[model samples]
Target: MKVTILTLGSRGDVQPYIALAREMIKNGHEVVICTGATFQRFIEENKVSFYPASADLMALMESEEGRDILNGNGFSLLKIIKFSKEKIAPSYRKSMDDFYQASQGADLIIYHPKALGAVDIALYFNIPCICLPPVPIMYPITEFPNFSLSSKKSFGPVLNRLSYKLVKFSELPFIKEINDFRGKTLKSPKRKAGLYTYDINGSPIPIIYPISPFLFKKVDSWKDSVFISGFFFLDSEEETLPNEIENFLEKGKKPIVVSFSSMPLKNPSIFRKKLVQALKKTNNRAVVLTGTSGMRFNQEENILTVEKAPHRLLFKRAKGIIHHGGVGTMSEALLSGVPQIIIPFAVDQPFWANLLYKKGYSIKPLQEKNLEVFELVQALEQVGNKEYIENAQKIKNIIQSENGIHRAVKHIESVVDNIKKE
Candidate 1:
């Protein structure tokens, strides 16, 4: 089988899909990754075929409007919509054309939510497409409100379902633009904009959530086609830290690993200083993996700031992790069996952080907008809670034992086999 996976975003966003691609290749399937140029080397290094998309999300982040949108308010729905309408309009056609180019001979299409053109192209090819969300937000569940609009409070079954409807309704703002792409670019039917995601596709598309059931227990509310196939955790390569960082780690007692990967901050300097003061207050050292957060610092006594390093290596040796609550980071931190101190910025981050807090894996999350030194210090102090530690270890045991990639491969094959039979 030939599989084409369409995706975008930061390193964490694309890394898990690479794991999926490599697994499929090993299983004797031809796999191609269609994504931004920033990840070409990254995808090729893993020996997967690479197809570059026209627009790069990192370049989008580096754009003036992208920085303004991403920096302060932290990735709210409105912010995403606004940016998509204004900045992304010129490139929307190009992105869809690229997806079409990438899907020329694909037997199946696996897509991240960011790559919205996958469905239409899949239709053009008469192939089945799978929605592969980084978080558990693609489908509606009665157990909780939609991940995007969820708050700290549970709204019961009815309202929880309605929250999902609200997310669907939010899609209305983009319907006309998407329809234009379908009709003009793909020469496809003019799709009616529905108040939800699947409605936009006009059929029930299979969705597979690459998250552990330990984090989100299996729910009875989902349709048979929706699956929870554990996290698509990338294979780790053995890598040593820089000499200076290794020295710093060896000198200190498990320094805190602070990595706000690709999350823009309004005032990175203030955020950096706040973390420093809090770490000092808690008598901890740190290694800050500041990728695309635009934070830079002079060499400090106990903190090491670098553009990138292997989280697989660093998280295991860290005292704890302080990070933006991206699903990828959340998965890595959980795998390391360490507590997390989450600063939720936007999208499904709050939901993941809240779930972790509720499940006793992390301290309560702090608002990235209003984070103060004292509050961070408090969360740091809570990092050593006996219950959190035990629970983290328990979750680790569960995750370590999961073969998500193998299971996911089976699931995808099953879907394709069923579609072929139909």
Candidate 2:
């Protein structure tokens, strides 16, 4: 079978799809990853075919409009949209062409949120396409509120349904643009924009949530079409730590690993200073992994900074982790059996952090807005608690035991087989 996975965004968004593609190739299928140009070498290095679909994510982040968003200006939605239109119009058009070409001659299409146009492309080709969301937002469920919304208060089933309605209506602005692209490019019948995400009548499409049920339990209100496979964790063949990291581990008691991969920072200096202060207050040594933002610091005997390191390898030796609560990072931390101190910025991160806290695996997450050194210290203090460590280990065991990638492969194969039978 030939499969093309359309995806974009940071490594957190793109990495899991690579895991899935690698698994498919091992199972005797051809797979290609359609993503940004920056990941071409990385994907090819992983032995997967690469299809460049957009500009590098870091380039997008470093753009003026992206800087505004990253700086926490709290711009209104309309202003943000307007900025995106002006900045991204040219690149987005080119990306659409790349996506259309990359998707040709595929047995199946799997897509993330950033590639919603893949739905129209798949429809044009009359092939099966699956919506794979790393988070729990696409489907409506009464079990809990949508991950995007900050509220956890439950009213009733009606309100639960309304939450999805709110998210659906939020797409109104982009609907015309998306439909216009379909009309011009694919020349297919006009599609209702909401159908790309939902089925107003029944189950719209196969929506797969590639996260552990242990982390987010299956909600009864979800439609039959939804499948909650465990997280598609990518365990690299090489797990060796770098010499400096090894030396750091040998030189002191286990240190907390702090990282904020891809989370835009308004002030790197303040953030760095607070992190150092928090570690000092807790009397903990630390390793900081800063990416793209070039977060730098003066060398200290107890602190080490690196551009990047494998979380799967480093988290196992660390006493605790302080991170942005990204799903990929959370999965790595959980599997490593390390307690976490989450400083969530936006978009489902706070949701994951709060779930961990509610499940007793970590303290309540500290919001990035107005974050202070004292609050970080307090969270670190909680990490030493016996209950939190025990809970972290329990969740770790659950995650470690699952064969997530194989299970996801099975799910994908089933979806493809059923489509063929039809």
Candidate 3:
């Protein structure tokens, strides 16, 4: 069978689906990944067919407007809607065209919620589409509001369920372009506004959420079609640390690994200065991962900075993990059995950070605006507290036991088998 996976947003969002594609290929199926043009080479390097379905989000995040969104204390659902309409709406035609062309002759479509075209595109082809959000935001949870919209007080469960409408709000800005793609491009029937959620067969689409049940179990309210598969990690080859990193790791205490992953920092200089001072004040050492996230720092005697490293490998050697709480980073840290210090920027990050802290996998999340040298030092010192470390290891054992990619593949095959029976 030919399988097409569609995703959007940052590398954090697209990386897991690439893992999923590889799993499908291992099962003797043709696999294609339709994502940003930036990932075409990366996809092909992994031996999966590549199709550019969206513009590179890294470029967007680097833009001034995108920086504003990230630096904000928290992103309200309303702010995201405004941002998407203003920045993302203009690119819809090209993105829809890309997805339309890439999806041709595919038996299945598994998509990130950001891949809004998948719903209509699946309908156009009469194929099954599975919603595969790497994060738990797309499914409603009774405990909290969606992502960054959470407050010090509860908005209550009614609003908590409604907050997952982030998917609908995020896509609202592109509806006109989606309609244009339907009418002018695909010659497909125009569907009404709101989420184009149901499959062509008039069934509620199945959703596969790749998160460890230990982090958040399947709630009673979720439907039969909603699955809580464990995290889908790539079957990575053995990787070696760089000479600089290797030497640094051997020098002193196992240093904390600090990375904000793909989050763009608005004031990186201030952030980096505070971090370095905090580490020194706590007399702890660190290895900072500074990718294109705008966190550039000169290597100090006690702190080392590298552009990239294998998180799965590097995290396990660290005494603690400090990061922006991207779902990908969260999963890797969980698997590493290392306690985390989450400095959430925006969106679902706050949700995950709070959850981890409450569950004793990490310290209480520190907001960037409220960030201080003393507070950071306190959190860094807390890293050695035995209780948090023990809880992290317990969660790690539970996640390591579950086979996320294998379980996800089984579900995909089951959906296809059901289609055949029909």
Top candidate on TM-score is 2
> On a 0 to 1 TM-score scale, where does candidate 3 land against the true structure?
0.92
- Per-residue lDDT tens digits for candidate 3, residues 266-376, read 678888899889888888899999975677777587889998898988999999999988889888998999989998877778778877787788899997775788999
lDDT values, one for every candidate? 0.81, 0.80, 0.81
Q: What lDDT does model 3 reach? A: 0.81
Q: Compose the digit string of candidate 1's lDDT tens values, residues 289-351.
A: 988776888878788888888887889888889888888888889999988889988877888
- Candidate 2 local lDDT, 1-422, one digit each (tens): 99999987778778999999999999999999998887787788789999987645556866766877766667678767776676555455566667788889998989986764777778778788888877878787777777666544666777776677665664455566666677788885666656766642353778888888766654677657688888888767865788999998998899999888877666778788888888888899999988754477998759999878989899989999988888999888889998888877788788888888888887888865688888988988988899889888898999877778888899889988987887
Candidate 2 yields a Cα-based lDDT of: 0.80
Runs in model 1 with CA error above 4 Å?
A: 73-83, 166-177, 194-196, 199-203
Q: Answer with 2 or 3, whichever has the higher lDDT.
A: 3
* C-alpha TM-score for every candidate: 0.92, 0.93, 0.92
Q: Which pairs in model 2 have colliding backbones?
A: none
Query: Model 1 clash pairs?
Result: 168-195, 168-196
